[model samples]
Target: DTAVSQTPKYLVTQMGNDKSIKCEQNLGHDTMYWYKQDSKKFLKIMFSYNNKELIINETVPNRFSPKSPDKAHLNLHINSLELGDSAVYFCASSLSGTQYFGPGTRLLVL
Candidate 1:
């Protein structure tokens, strides 16, 4: 079974559109996270959820939202997507600080 999985591995849309990416993990981890990798290969954490409670990174914009229905799932929603939002979004799950990442969802904003 996959430890972590993300849906719609690729997303292509125009600027200002809204989109969402879904993530699920079967690893029974208590902590999950959303990360974005930019074109320059810089990876940054956007949001984190531990047992369904949110802990968002201060640098993340309000346009980005992370929702967790339970410990095994975390979904990301983007509103009024901008060109700068085009990047690879990764879903990760951790047990005691050791993280396992999903394949990632590539978003392209035109």
Candidate 2:
């Protein structure tokens, strides 16, 4: 689910490089999230981890990987970056059906 998401472009790397971002939530929430930048310049839910179960959208590419080491932290690892992967990745955590998102990390695969 998308909210009034914040998008801040920052990372720029070359193709074939691996990119990773870590997210942590201190609200005692039980779920962590990974979202992708939409072509419309918005953000959309791409992966969600809850109760040790990970739910990934089928549309997500194989180059992307999501990991949750614990309830408070989550990680998104991208391998072999492609030009198409250039976009902001939004990190979030949710509890009681409300989500709190980060400013987002912008990836540019050149």
Candidate 3:
């Protein structure tokens, strides 16, 4: 019984490498989102998909792309990872304003 799940709770990678984080939700929510929390613990919305359509895209780098195969899953792919990309990535879901987030995927770039 998983509400929201993401793979590799911790990821340590080298700069310029490409990696992908997978996410899935058991809740029947129509909207899903990806958020990034920096070292300061500032949570910011990166992307949001509603019914499989791109809804929100923040000032994230083009190297970061989000894919939503279905309402239950949204995966994030990063290319040419940088030290600044070393942060925690979170996947969330919601039908309205209230969203539920995953534990988070911590990426450490060296």
lDDT digits (tens) for residues 15-96 of candidate 2 = 9999787776677888778888855798778898995579655578888888788887788888999988888888888889
Please list the C-alpha lDDT of all candidates, in the order they appear. Answer: 0.94, 0.78, 0.94
Query: What's each prediction's TM-score?
Result: 0.97, 0.85, 0.97
Give the clash count for model 1: 0
Tens digit per residue, CA lDDT, model 1, 4-31: 9999899999999999999999999999
Q: Please, what are the lDDT tens digits per residue for candidate 3 over residues 3-86?
A: 989998999999999999999999999999999999999999999999889999999899999999988989999999999999
lDDT of 2 at 38: 55
List candidate 2 segments past 4 Å from native. 1-9
Q: How many steric clashes between backbone atoms does each model show? A: 0, 0, 0
RMSD vs true structure, all candidates? 0.8, 4.2, 0.7
- Predicted structure 2: lDDT: 0.78
lDDT value for model 1: 0.94
Candidate 3: list runs displaced more than 4 Å: none
